[model samples]
Target: EAGVAQSPRYKIIEKRQSVAFWCNPISGHATLYWYQQILGQGPKLLIQFQNNGVVDDSQLPKDRFSAERLKGVDSTLKIQPAKLEDSAVYLCASSSVIGGEQFFGPGTRLTVL
Candidate 1:
C-alpha cells in the first residue's frame, strides 16, 4: 500500500499571493490531517478530517487558510494572501483511526517573501 502523497514539494511566493497544496492519503485510511511546521518548532495541526468531514480546525487561520478532504481520500489545502510568517512546510498525514499511528507525506515547503 502507498503512503501519503503531496505535490509541489517546494513553493516560493510573495506575501499576499495565493498557494495551494494537494495530498492523497493511504488506501483505506479514514483520517487525514494537515500541519504546518516552522523552522525550529514541531508541526502544529492545522486541520483534520474523517472521511470527508472536518474533525478539527481549531488552530487553522480561517481568514487565510482553508482545506477540504472531499471523497474521504484526497485533500487540498489553500493559503490565500499568504504571509511571510506562513513560510513553512505543509505536511499531510493519514491514519486508520483516531490516535493511531499516522503516515506522513514528504510535505510542501512554502517560502513566502
Candidate 2:
C-alpha cells in the first residue's frame, strides 16, 4: 500500500506570517493524525481524525493552529501568525483502524525566521 503523502517538503517564513500544509492519507485508511516534531524531540501528536470526524485535538495549539479532514481522505493544517517556536517538521500519518499500525508521510519542514 502507498504511504501517506505530504506537500512542500520544506517551507520558510517569517514570524507572524501564515502557512499551510497539506496531507493525503492512504486509501481506505480510517484514522488520520497530524504530529509536530521539534528539533531534538520526539514527534507530538497534534490532532487525530476518524473518518472526517475529529477524534482528538487536546494537544493542538488552537490559538495559532488549525486542521481539518473534511472528506476523510485529505487533510490540511494551518498556522496563522507563526512564531519562531513553531519551527518544526509537520508529519501526517494514517492507520487502517484506531490504534493500529500507522504509515507516515515524508513531512513538511517549516522554518520560522
Candidate 3:
C-alpha cells in the first residue's frame, strides 16, 4: 500500500501570516492524525479524525490552529497569525484502526520568521 502523502515539504512564513498544509492518507485507513514535532522533541498529537468527524482536538490551539478531514480521505491543517513557537515539522499519519500501527507522511516543515 502507498504511504500517506503530504504537500509543501517545507514552508517559511513571517509571524502573523497564515499557512495551510495538506495530507492524504492511505486508501483504506480509517483513522487520521496530525502531529507537531519541534526540533529535538517528539511529535505531539494535535488532532485525530475518524472518517469525516473529529475524534480528538483538545491539544490543538483553537486560537490559531484548525484542521478538518474531508469525506474521510484528505485532511488539511491551517494556522493563522503564525507565531515563532509554531515553527516545527507537521506530520500526518493514519491507521487502519484506533491504536493500530500508524503510517506517517514525510511532513511539512514550517519555519516561522
Candidate 4:
C-alpha cells in the first residue's frame, strides 16, 4: 500500500510569520496525528483526529497552531505568527485505531530565522 505523503520536506521562515504544511495519510486508516519533534527529542503529539472529529489536541499550541482533517483523509496544519521556538520537524502519522502502531511521513522540517 502507498505510504503517507507530505510536501516541501523543509521550510524556512522568520519568527512571527505564518506557515502551513500538508499531509495525506494511508488509505483506509481512521486515526491521524500531528507531532512536533524538536532536535534530540522524541515526537510530541500535537493533535489527533478520528475521521473529521478531533480526538486530542491538548499539546497543540492553540495560540499559534491549528489543524484540520476535512474528509478524514488529508489534513493540514497551520501556524500563524510563528515563533523561533516553533522551528522543528512536523510529523504526520496515522494508525488503524487508537493504541495502534503509527506510520509516519518524512515530515516537514521548519527553520525559524
Show the colliding residue pairs in model 3: none
Clashes of each: 0, 0, 0, 0
**lDDT comparing candidate 1 with the true structure:** 0.96
Report the lDDT tens digits of candidate 4 across residue range 1-113: 99989987999999988999999999988999999999999999999999989999999999899999998989999999999999899999999888888999999999999
Write down the RMSD of all candidates, one decimal each. 0.7, 0.6, 0.6, 0.7
Cα TM-score of candidate 3? 0.98
Model 1 earns a TM-score of 0.97
Question: Per-residue CA lDDT of candidate 2, range 20-70, in tens?
Answer: 999999999999999999999999999999999999999999999999988
Candidate 2: regions farther than 4 A off: none
Q: Indicate whether candidate 1 or candidate 4 has the larger TM-score.
A: 1
Stretches of candidate 3 exceeding 4 Å from the true structure: none
Q: Against the true structure, candidate 4 has what lDDT?
A: 0.94
The residue pairs in collision within model 1 are none
Instruction: Estimate TM-scores for all models.
Output: 0.97, 0.98, 0.98, 0.97
**Model 2 accuracy (lDDT, Cα):** 0.97
- Candidate 2, residue 70: how far the Cα is off, in Å: 0.7
Candidate 2's TM-score: 0.98
lDDT of each: 0.96, 0.97, 0.97, 0.94
Q: Worst lDDT window (10 residues) for model 2?
A: 1-10
Worst 10 residues of 3 by lDDT: 66-75
Question: Would you give me the overall lDDT of model 3?
Answer: 0.97
Give per-residue CA lDDT, model 1, range 1-113, as digits (tens).
Answer: 88899998999999999999999999988999999999999999999999999999999999999998878889999999999999999999999998899999999999999
Which residue pairs collide in model 2, if any? none
lDDT of 4 at 43: 96
